[model samples]
Target: MSYAEHFSLKNIPYGIASTQDRPAAVATRLHDLIFFLSDLNLDSPATLNALASIDKDELVKLRRTLQTALGDEKNVSRFGIPVGEATMHLPIEVKGFTDFSCSTEHLLNAGEAVLGVRSFPPASLHLPIGYTGRSSSIVVSGTPITRPYGQYRDGEEIGFGPSRAVDYELEMGAIIGKPSTFGDRVSVNDADEHIFGVVIVNDWSARDIQGFEMQPLGPMNGKSFGTSISPWVVTLEALEPFATEPPAKKTPVKAYLQDNKIKSSYSITLNAEVLSEGSATEVCKAQLQWMYWTFRSLVAQQTINGCNVNTGDILGTGTVSGVGDDEHGCLLEMTKGGKVEWELSTGKKRRYLEDGDGVRLTAYAGDGVGFGECTGVISAAKPF
Candidate 1:
């Protein structure tokens, strides 16, 4: 259970934590120590949002200063708190969330399950298809996800009650550090300037409700219930070493979405585990490099229609699935829309999550460099 390696000196990811004697405040991690920055005087308004909104160069300077501070034993003694004694909180005050379907493999797999075809709509190749999501439901890791109630088709009759097909979508969330004004567009080349960091996102879903309602429009109640994210926000600079080129586009993109000059994808490995009956079983392993659309392009697409973005906003790279059964991101696809049962190492068979199932997501470039676990346990639904 020790995640100290994820917070090595090489990665000073930012977050917020609270201890018995301290109020929730901005903090950063180095190894197993959590250092609150309120005393560092990084800005007049000492919050992660303020720190994120600062100029990129100034933020870089702050990173270097913290790295240097964490190296000194005297400084560690003065400010560092054992992470075991602290409770992690949501790292950002997210006001908006947009999740994009960027993985071609996931799209095709989902299509095959839901529509009996392993093909994507032509529009998916031309644009980064996405939908606005409920930001208020976003929570930090370890939070419990309540099983949601919604309407669905039960044989020939419409049914209403707790969803029977609760699922999880493994994704990476891009945190917007800088704000953009209304009526202004962000070009792909300048997208990095606006992004602060990345975190693991578990886009909790209700497959039965989603399948019944997602026609003519997109997900609503099925998706808006809850979204769990890692507490640590791994800075973009820390991931520079992992940058890699994304797959080539089969069709050219619009001029505003062009990013031939930038290597916009990272070579991060993603994994999901089902924790049940005191055991953790690895259900899926995927690669972020398989995403067809670059993270930068998501920013470009978000702002292309003059939609303003603000600090703490989230852009989700939806369901980062690769090829094969073991690489599927969600149970809905892996189970072929409930036709097959997924058996965990604990010997429990499930087509979707049961009331007490736990889902944990982890992403990293290498040892000692990772976004710590994004975890959530399912709770029984309230009666309708």
Candidate 2:
């Protein structure tokens, strides 16, 4: 009955796993063992998305079944699938992925440097701003992030090359489990019924590439390179103990987003590090409390437009930055867009990541680690 808080008997989070000879199957973790859902007569599960599309009642029933099976001493051996022999795959099949801007601190800090403005557009004050990200580019943790190449504006001269400013953004993604029909809307209070869990996301960015192409609409090649995510999906019900009120809103949102009265945040603590040239540097630590738009509210806003949300759709909370310099979420904010070199504990300093720099991020809530580390090392860009 005992396991880490992240994946305990009470928290049977789902994911996809496989051994060399076995096909991909749905699974839940209690400790070292991965309880394969297929063995429970939930056979041949290709992915968690199949279960995600089921009704809320069914989802609850399955969760409870896993919880009960793991709790019973007699059922333990049968459910204990060897986790060491398995490989964890992406938890869900992301049919649609949306990246939302939720941290005012990020906008404020990044805007000044990237856009030469003190604030984001006025639209940010009213509704959640998001862009459809490349679903195909979303890779699991441990994947390498190849530096992207695109046309860059070099003082009015257009040049195509690899980005000089590569950065990592610390964020949490809400995994949508329940399906909603087109034109259906959800309130902030009911959003949880649709959200299966949370996962750590590292939305890698290439400043030079993003900067040049983001003007006409939103990001393009700069963002499509690669985004990394942790393997486990920690259910919200398990995180209920960590729930806390969001910060006092400095800017008010619209009607649908305010249904919860601003109590929709979690107390998860997030941190990022860089392993470069044999030196590991602790970059920043931030909490989800600093997020301007809570996950529930973000869901309400997304569906408010009458857009149908699929079972595996992921709503990403953009860079969760806090108030202090030590709490910045991305290197752009911490270094002021590469204008300042941040000192590392190893006596080295960096303005941006160089080749071979491995970026790893982790989040925690109490003693247990949040969604395992979402890691990606930088590789030199492909040839132009």
Candidate 3:
């Protein structure tokens, strides 16, 4: 399909969430047509009072309807809703979406910084490296991210306190629609079949907390506190036009990570911006195609262990960094593990996130399938 013909304004993403106006709502967009699952229920008195007011019953019904609509091309349109008529309270909704760390490049870079070496243990490379993160901590864009308090120790001293070095990770996230049981291995060819949609994910980090606890096992307090994602979930079907081959690997992957054929990595452009108190500035711009691994590989490896994945489970394509200096994904890398300073346009410099700092991440795939933006502003740790 031609680029112009593929992406049209009508193709807004779908997501299940609550807004200030309608606490429980299922929203979909087709150009200016905003349809809430609630709108389908014309029988509610609230529906008659305001065509856009989404109630609990409407959301539950929509969820049931969409669950059945997935995987059937004929029923796909049944999930779409107009954007113009969407409720006014929609913008104020609190977003809840989980993220995963599935990128090989991101893992390697982070390891090199802390471990003083490149690459990871052979087991990590051979297997799909991942960890389960908190989904309840997921918040919508523009929400304030509080610096978390956790266990910290430097050298001989260990204590419980607030994070001293807060940080941000630029990542892309995928939303699962259908679920599979334990012991079921999914193939790359069928990976997309199980996927529901995509969203921008910000896996916030407490560098100080991570630095202290990440040994033997992976992240615990370093990750669980809070993670943020965009409110909109652009469907995989919409992103087909932008698909491109995943990055060439430096080494062969294990049998489980291998793909029958090369697949597209979605030619999307990603950017990050920093906003200090009273000021906002763009930090970096990179491409989604730069990923060293594919989302399909991540999903495939996840289920190889026979572990079952649920519908709301999220996977983050770790910080998507490239070879160039400007392409680095987090303040840790951009500043070379805090050894250098990241100079911003406002003439400010940062080694790590500070109190009252806001970080914004955005991505756009081709012309039509844009994932919009996901942002999180930092708040100082609560006084001890």
Candidate 4:
């Protein structure tokens, strides 16, 4: 099927692809074929950073030209390669990654699951709560995550070993397209122009390590290990058709954080599944609209203090969980902090991920306009 019949040509997303004869190049997907933008003689750069730095109108024009080219058989045959024959690489050279706890349902579920309560911190209602993560460890999807070795307390015995409570967090990552000066404040109204696109993110977690290390300080070694993102970047323009109003907040935010002009959330649905011993079982289903804060809100909060943000910087919506237990986004919340065991496809029970278990997260809007799969498998930890 052609791109038009299968999906909206407007859904053209960008990525990095390589073949046996070709080195890695910036590419775009149409149906099952990948086309290198550099082949189009459009002054395409080698990396997404340069593309992101261009004017928004220029980006739109490039996309439109590509769409027009797709209609020509000669253009398809000249520059397109079967996607299966190519290897996908990390799409962006990330400089920084910030993850925010933006789902109220996720917070409430976590409080009830871990602490026998159902409430959130007061500060969360006012602004997005987030943490700066190690961007160096962010890998493209399909990269195997080695279970990290770290310290954990087991019945008063603090021991160090490969983490027993490894988990996956389903999230959506916003890619920064524009730069901000160190002293400039970006209001919520301007956040859209600064963001280039969205990608599926799997912010892998080591729950036992996090529990042992997170006391006065927040997540450190537990979270710094690995994060996975889907190869394709679905630009914001492609998602505008699916944009919807964010849930109305009961508590009002400050004037600077308010969004009065634009719909900030998308009606995207996400699903997480585990592949064990060749069998795959669906684990969770979530909605991106469940988040309490919007992407605009996060961008404004990050810059309100005069913190500069540059192209390729990422902001992640942490664990996009919904209202039900089955909709919980991670093993820590799904298994009730290891107190309960979830049954997998192989008839095995797990409170957390086991070595060789693969996890896949997928997301989409109406008629399968989607962010491609974000997947990772667990491997045994290396010797100390």
Candidate 5:
């Protein structure tokens, strides 16, 4: 079958592939055949930055050219490589990463249960709250996450050791395709144009470490260890069919944040599942639309201050917790700060992840088409 008929023509996801001799090749796939973009002279850079560096019109042209080539039988014999022969790498060259906390229920639940607070900061209402994260640690899916060690509050005393509360944050990661110079700002109305695509993010967290260091500042060692992202880049243009109008803001945003054109938030269904002891149980099944703030809102807020953003920078949509327990996005929220225990389908119980456990996150835009799953297996930390 050709790209249009079998691979879902609507989704022309991109990724980096490599063979034993060649460490990298930018390519697109349709079933077992991988089409190297270089064959068509459409892509040359080792990273997606080449695609991002170009303007929207150029992007459309490159995609269109590739689409036509993939549909032609003669082109396949020249550009295609067997999928089994190549290895996948991180899809983009990540220069920076920022994680935004945008779920109302997450903030409220975590604040009350973890910190015993009752109200949110006034600024949180006016802006989307977020913090910079360690971009060097972001890895492709299938990477193993070694549990991290950090200073944690143990009972009445503080101690440093391997974290006991290892967790995974289910999120959608937006990739910045357009670079903005330092001091340049993108308004809410134009934010969508700057976004290239999205990938599923597994922001691994050590609850004990995060909880201890979060007060003085935002996450540090608690979150710096490792983050896994799905290799496929699902373009925003493909999601037009599933876009939804976000709920009316309780408090309207500032003038720059207003954009009637920014009408729909992609309605992607997100799922987080844990596989342990040969058993699998889904922990979170929610939708991206449930987030209190949408991507346009988050991106605009991030650039409100004169911050230069580069192509390949990853921005995460905090945890996508919905209203119910089943809709919760992480163990910290589902267990209510580890106050409860969750039993798996195999009858195994968990307060947090154990070594050898596999955590996977999957997402779909409409009905059942998906961007694939991002997953990581827990491993013991190196000896102290």
Candidate 6:
């Protein structure tokens, strides 16, 4: 579906983090509001208990005085604390985020483009594939991302340095609320009950660093550097109307991963835009929709190994790329390993991202449930 028809300003996504100006705030497009649970000066313990049970709305408003102070730019004096004081750090206490590799088109394209293979790994066809990523690196959108430094090897020998190939992966992420134990494997039918909401995730990549290290095992430091996510978490209940079937499987799947009652995916439009330093032009626009596996399958398969998952654990959908020329997820694929060039609207060309380039990834469910935006700007690598 077209973007304008589906997304709107009222539907802000939620995220948990400490901003530079306000150490802990509920980020929305209009402004960030500081939430102080301990200092509300409740009439009684029951009032505080009642506040805790009132949901995110009541909790946001109980602290409106803080909001007023923040709005008037007098928060430091009003609270008798530092201007950006945060009594507590943001944690997974509210929601758990997870990444899933459900996009078959992206997996296939990336394999062919990066590994010179035309098909998916046989293991992926039968089950949803995923890996655990660092939740600590997950930052609120609009945060400045520092380029990660790691080891690299272009010619069989490993050496340490700042990454030469940094890229962005366009994907959706899910928030987990209900937890499960190590011995419990949720059936596909019951997966949605464990989910709380969804958010846009920019799983930043250091392709060159990853290429050198990702053999024998999967991504490590290459993927651990940082992950950018939208602040607002859009609830699953809000997205119920947009459920749709995922692309048909080219190969057969195991019974445990299939769900007759639930459709596997949503027909959401995903796009990525890059802004280079000193340029007013939008560098790229990539759409998302051609995924192989659905979010439900990923959740079901995650527990197959008897691994327990908690409320805030994140599962990232790997980069969602399509078959068209403008749909590639990263520059590595768009430029075909830098063997081709991408023409921007400004008439300039790019093979890969340069320092100071800002990348933004956005997505929304077809029925108007917007997941908001995930964005990060690349800074120059620390001087060697």
Best by lDDT: 1
List runs of model 1 lying over 4 Å from the truth.
40-44
> Tens-digit lDDT track for model 3 on 40-80?
54243222112213333453454445444433444345544
What number of clashing residue pairs does each candidate have, in the order they appear?
Answer: 0, 0, 13, 0, 0, 22
Where model 4 places Cα greater than 4 Å from the true spot, the runs are: 1-8
Provide TM-scores for the models: 0.97, 0.93, 0.80, 0.97, 0.93, 0.77
Instruction: Report the error of model 1 at residue 16, Å.
Output: 1.0
Question: Per-residue CA lDDT of candidate 6, range 208-304, in tens?
Answer: 7887787967787888788887655665655666677677787788888777854557667777888775454443354434677766777788888
Clashing pairs in 1: none
TM-score (C-alpha, index-matched) for candidate 2: 0.93
Q: Write the per-residue lDDT of candidate 1 for residues 56-99, one digit (tens) a residue.
A: 89888888988887888888888889889999999999979999
Once fitted onto the true fold, the runs of candidate 6 whose alpha carbons sit more than 4 angstroms away are 1-98, 155-159, 278-289, 366-368
Can you list the residue pairs that collide in candidate 2? none
lDDT per residue for candidate 4 within 1-384, as digits (tens), equals 122322346688889889999999898887778888888666788998889877788888888888898767898888888877889999999988999999988788777776788999668889999899889999999999999999998888998999989999999999999888999999999899899999999999998899889886879888888999998898888888889988898697899888975578888889999989999988999989888998988999999999999999999999899878789899888988889987987888888999999999988876636876889999999996
Of 4 and 5, the candidate ranking higher by TM-score: 4
Question: What is candidate 4's CA lDDT for residue 340?
Answer: 92
Model 6 lDDT on a 0 to 1 scale: 0.63
Q: Which residue pairs collide, candidate 5?
A: none
**Which runs in model 2 stand beyond 4 Å of their true positions?**
1-5, 40-45, 73-82, 367-369
Instruction: Give the TM-score comparing model 4 with the true structure, all chains together.
Output: 0.97
Those runs of model 5 whose alpha carbons end farther than 4 Å from true positions after fitting are: 1-7, 41-43, 74-79, 367-369
What's the residue-level lDDT of 122 in candidate 6? 69
| Reference-based lDDT, residue 354, model 1 | 91
Give the CA lDDT, 0 to 100, for residue 248 in model 1. 91
